[model samples]
Target: MDLQIIQNRIIEIRGQRVMLDFHLAELYEVETKVLKQAVRRNIERFPEDFMFELTKSELDKLRSQTVTFDWKPTTYAPFVFTEQGVAMLSSVLKSKKAIRVNVEIIRAFVQLRKLAIQNSEIIHRIDEMEKKYDKQFKEVFTALRYLIHPPEKERRRIGYKK
Candidate 1:
């Protein structure tokens, strides 16, 4: 499986990297229901940090940002799996396809981690350089830091705007 394909599916939720169950099922070539059933059967293997259901607000926030996925409000909030949770999935899902997909997914996560570390190092370097320079270059260094790690934008309200 392509690394970018898996990376695109990964999203940040609750300040942690996670993949939605539906996406995992798609990668595993299994129906979402079947995947959920298998997980339910092996609940002991997953812990809170490994996997957790999305809160209503989190689901709504995702739906508001995404247009490609028709995410209607369902009774059960979708479960999101962290990197560790995804690793555990291989044990629950005995199929060869599932195991292969799991490996690819883990690779994608590792690649993303590497990219994050690179950006952090770049940011650290900028900070060090900023301290050495006078006030004239202060703005330049600030801009560079922002470019490397942009701040989160304020989310708009869901109701109709006044």
Candidate 2:
């Protein structure tokens, strides 16, 4: 279980980091349907905050943006499992592979958290420095801000004569 591979499977939905059922099933070495069935059987173990089914519109938006290999061209939307939901899955799955994969998934989530915290710290330090240097480094700070958040694309004028 490579950490990068696991991290790539994790995505943001509704402002929460989550893993899709199909990705979890692949990591757990079980069929998607079987994994979903296990979760359904132990529904009480997973609360709304722990797990939720993707809405049709959300699924459609995801499909349009990325190639979801595991999802079939069917009407059923996928279930998303949060960090807590993924940790709970090990108990429901009751398999050595499931337990091992869950550990790796948890590690990936923790790594992401650490990276986010470090990023915020860096941004805070940059802000403090900018305040200390005031107008002296205004252009430099502006460039840094642009690097942090680039502007969105602008449409070109239509039917330009010259």
Candidate 3:
């Protein structure tokens, strides 16, 4: 599977990087219901930290913000699996495809973590540079910060003049 496709399926929820049941099912080449049944049968393997059901509000927010073209709002809340939960799934699933998909998913998660670490290092180096430089470089650092983390929305026109 393409790493970018896997990475796109992984999302942040409640500050945790997770894959929803539907996505995992698609990757495992099983019906979502079948996957949920497997997880239910081996519920003990999943603790709160490993997996959790998305709350209605969380699901709504996710639907509103993300490309959930394949997913329609359903009465049942989706289950989200963290990295640990995904690792456990390989044992529960016990299929060659499941194992292979799990490996790819795990690699995607690892790549995301590595990127996060690299970004932090870059930010730290930028901070050190700012400290060494004077106020003259403040705008440069500000521009970098904006590039790294852009504002959610454009700022309103200040003191508007025709």
Candidate 4:
């Protein structure tokens, strides 16, 4: 029900962001097996672009790296649902919670994209400012160095410490 919980389920897999089947099932308040079965029944709805099973290596890497789940290394690898796949899932899931959660997940993704774009723009502007000030900063430092240490001809002791 909480959007924040659903948003954190988004993860990067196979060079694209996706949601794992178990996380989706949890969000939908369904068992993982039920979710997988529903997807199987509506296989045509989910094309390769929409959903794909994780390769053994990929699954292994996820299991080893993630602290989130205690997934046993089963004979079958987990399925990943892309943005499109998530959208399609609502039709197959056939529950009020699934529908509401799907909508929330979509909104969360859009918000995430907006935040990423805003951050990138801020970083680009800061980089430009750094470049613009680099030469000016170097010149100021050079002038300060000269002021701190004058030529030998201009060097004269004003007073000696006792």
Which candidate number would show the highest lDDT if scored against the true structure? 3
lDDT of 1: 0.90
Candidate with better TM-score, 3 vs 4: 3
Q: Candidate 4 lDDT (Cα, whole model)?
A: 0.83
lDDT of 3: 0.93
Worst 10 residues of 1 by lDDT: 66-75
lDDT, residue 66, model 3:
81
Report the number of backbone clashes for model 1.
0
| Candidate 3's TM-score | 0.92
Candidate 1, residue 152: CA error in Å? 6.4
TM-score of 1: 0.89
Clashes (candidate 3): 0
lDDT of 2 at 2: 97
Candidate 1 lDDT over 19-118, as tens digits, reads 9998898899998889889999999999999999988898889987777664645578888999999999999999999999999999999999999999
Best by TM-score: 3
Per-residue CA lDDT of model 4 for 20-100, tens digit only, reads 998888888898889999999999999998999999889879886687775755577888998899999999988898999
The estimated TM-scores of all candidates read 0.89, 0.89, 0.92, 0.77
**On residues 1-162, what C-alpha lDDT tens digit does candidate 3 reach at each position?**
899999999999999999999999999999888999999999999999999999888988988778654876567899999999999999999999999999999999999999999999999999999998849799999999999999899657768689
lDDT of 2 by residue, 57-155 (tens): 898888866774555765568899999999999999999999999999999999999999998998898899999997999999889989987997885
Task: Judge candidate 4 at residue 135 and give its lDDT.
Answer: 74
Q: In order, what is each prediction's RMSD in angstroms?
A: 2.3, 4.1, 4.9, 15.6
Report the lDDT of model 4 for residue 15. Answer: 76
How displaced is residue 119 in candidate 4, in Å? 1.5
